[model samples]
Target: MNIGFDGKRAANNLTGLGNYSRSLIAQLAGFFPQNRYFVYTPKIKNHPQINRFLSIPNILTELPNVPGLFWRTSGIKKQLLKDNIDLFHGLSHEIPLGIHKSGIPSVVTIHDLIFLKFPQYFGRIDRFIYNLKFRYACKNSNRIVAISEQTKNDIIEHFNIDPEKIEVIYQSCDDSFKIASTDQLKESVRLKYQLPEKYILNVGTIETRKNLLTLVKALKQINEDHVLVVVGRKTKYADLVNQEIDKLNLRPRIIFLQDIPFNELPSIYQMAAVFVYPSVYEGFGIPVIEALYAHVPVVAATGSCLEEAGGKYSSYVSPFDHNGFAKAINHILDHPKVQKEMIEKGKDYVQRFNTEIISKEMMGLYTDVLKLHRSQHSNDAQLSTRPQRSRRSQRTSKN
Candidate 1:
């Protein structure tokens, strides 16, 4: 089977979507090398993640014939047909327009409906365009993959897609987070970042929806002397967060670590006493999983798919409840027994998202989609070939 993937994220993005695309593609090749996989990206970024993706066996990367805004949206359909793509998978929220018209079965992974769910954070024009493409893909694709049950529910409610048409597949972080950092590695990373000796960690974009201010407020409530370490790129939201931090007189207790190399992330995770994620909403909270794999006790926000990612042992609190978050973090920090339980149980829970299991599930979905397409085609052929009674015979019989 020749499988084609929309690889724009895999080739360019270094964050959430990029990691998902690269990890899934690499795992599929590892498990199912008998099939050929082609990655199509409009532009490629020279990054280590892309290099790792390119290194995978039984995979080929292609670029668009000519550059245009709609290359991935509509122009790629003709190229997919030319490649004899048996199936196409959109790694992000959409697939090429009219792909079904080219006689190619397709699957699209809708990671979230965040723009629709939280419209205030997005521009009107951007929201309109996103809604158009997402609705189309949900209706046209042979199957839809949602990263979590929450996201799957969102798709059905927002797009009115059949519940059975959407499949909820869990996503995992990079396997690197699972490895324990050596004493030497930990020392190097700590010194390099000038990280706090003891801190509560939060990793994600410092954006409004991420709710970093709440975490800072929680920090002020904590009785312990530990500081807070934030690791992510800052958007304009950082300015508001900074203002709040200053107003609360918590600047001395906060450390913002920027542009830290990806290779050192696991060590940073290992050094933290506890991980706190206070995002108000998420399709799936991946940083929570990374913390779990790092064997750190987690206290994350409620009202989203985080529980699914963090599992039963990780503590949960309302995103707005700074006091509640503080209590949860302090509990993990103060109680060694509780921390042990969370660490051990979290390790067991996150195994459900390991690469081998995800690879098998992904391939199973592809096979099921092709089977459904072939079954429908067979029925259509039967209808087209079925003999019909002549008009004269019908009239004579009626008389």
Candidate 2:
């Protein structure tokens, strides 16, 4: 079987869906050596890493340089038909309409429906197009892969998709995130980023959905010597977030490291006094899993999918309750015994979400879909070969 993945967005983005695409595909290639893969990417000058994936006998097909219309490149269908791809997977929500028109079996991974859930968060044109693309993907795909049970429920409730067609495959943390030699790695990362020795860590895009304002407010109320270290790429809300920090007069205690390499993240997680992720909405919070894998005591948001990822191990807090969040942080900081227990529980909790298990489950879904499709085609072919006799004669013969 030949598999095709959308590697265009993945080659560029360092966050969220991109990381998920890269990691999941890499693990699939490693685990399923028998299947062939073709990764379709956009035409770019200096994408060198695409060549590295060739070690798995994969081919890279580049899209043309069409402005605002590159995603609809019908050339991908020509390539897929030429390459005889048995299955094509959209790692993101965007699926080329040509693929659906060509009657190909395509599966799309719907990370989340945040834009649909909160239309006010997005602008007019974006919200309009997002709903359009989301509805098309939900209605046309052969199967939908939801990263969490929460996301699957959202799909069923929001879009009227058949539950049988959706599979819940939880996302896993990066394989490199594990219990590290804290003294050495921590000091190295801390010095490199000029990080405080005793600090609470928060790693996510600083957006309204992340509930950064509540965290900033909570920081002002906490009476510890600990600083709040935020690590993520700068987004549109960076200025607004800074204003919120200034308003709280907690600028000195808030450290924002906007530019950091992915390799340094695990060590940073290890160095944290405790990791807090108070996101208001998520498909599956990957950072919570990362913190757990790093054996860091985590305080995650209560109602979101992070609860599923954190299980009974993490301290839960509301996204809007600044006082409650501060109290939880103080409780963890004060009790060394409770912190140690949480750390141990975190390690045990993350073991159930290993990449190997996730990869295997995904492969099983692929195999099952392939078999079902194959059997249907076989039955159709047999029916086509049979002679068409008169119904009355057939009924008489049966009598």
Best by TM-score: 1
Candidate lDDT (C-alpha), each: 0.91, 0.81
Question: How do the residues 1-399 of candidate 2 rate in per-residue lDDT, one tens digit apiece?
Answer: 888887776566667876787778878878887887777776433444433443445444445433355444455677677778888888888677767667467888998988888777889999889888877887887789999999999999999999999999999876878647557776888898898879999999888788887888888877559999998777777788888887878888988887676678888888889899988988899999999998889997887688899989789998899898999988999999999999998888888788889999988888787787778878999999999999999999999
Please write out the lDDT profile of model 1 over residues 78-121, one tens digit for every residue. Answer: 78888888999998988888998888999999999999999999
Clashes of each: 0, 0
Model 2 Cα displacement at 51 (Å)? 6.6
TM-score, cand. 2: 0.92
Query: How many backbone collisions does model 1 have?
Result: 0
lDDT for residue 30 in candidate 2, whole number 0-100 = 80
TM-score of 1: 0.97
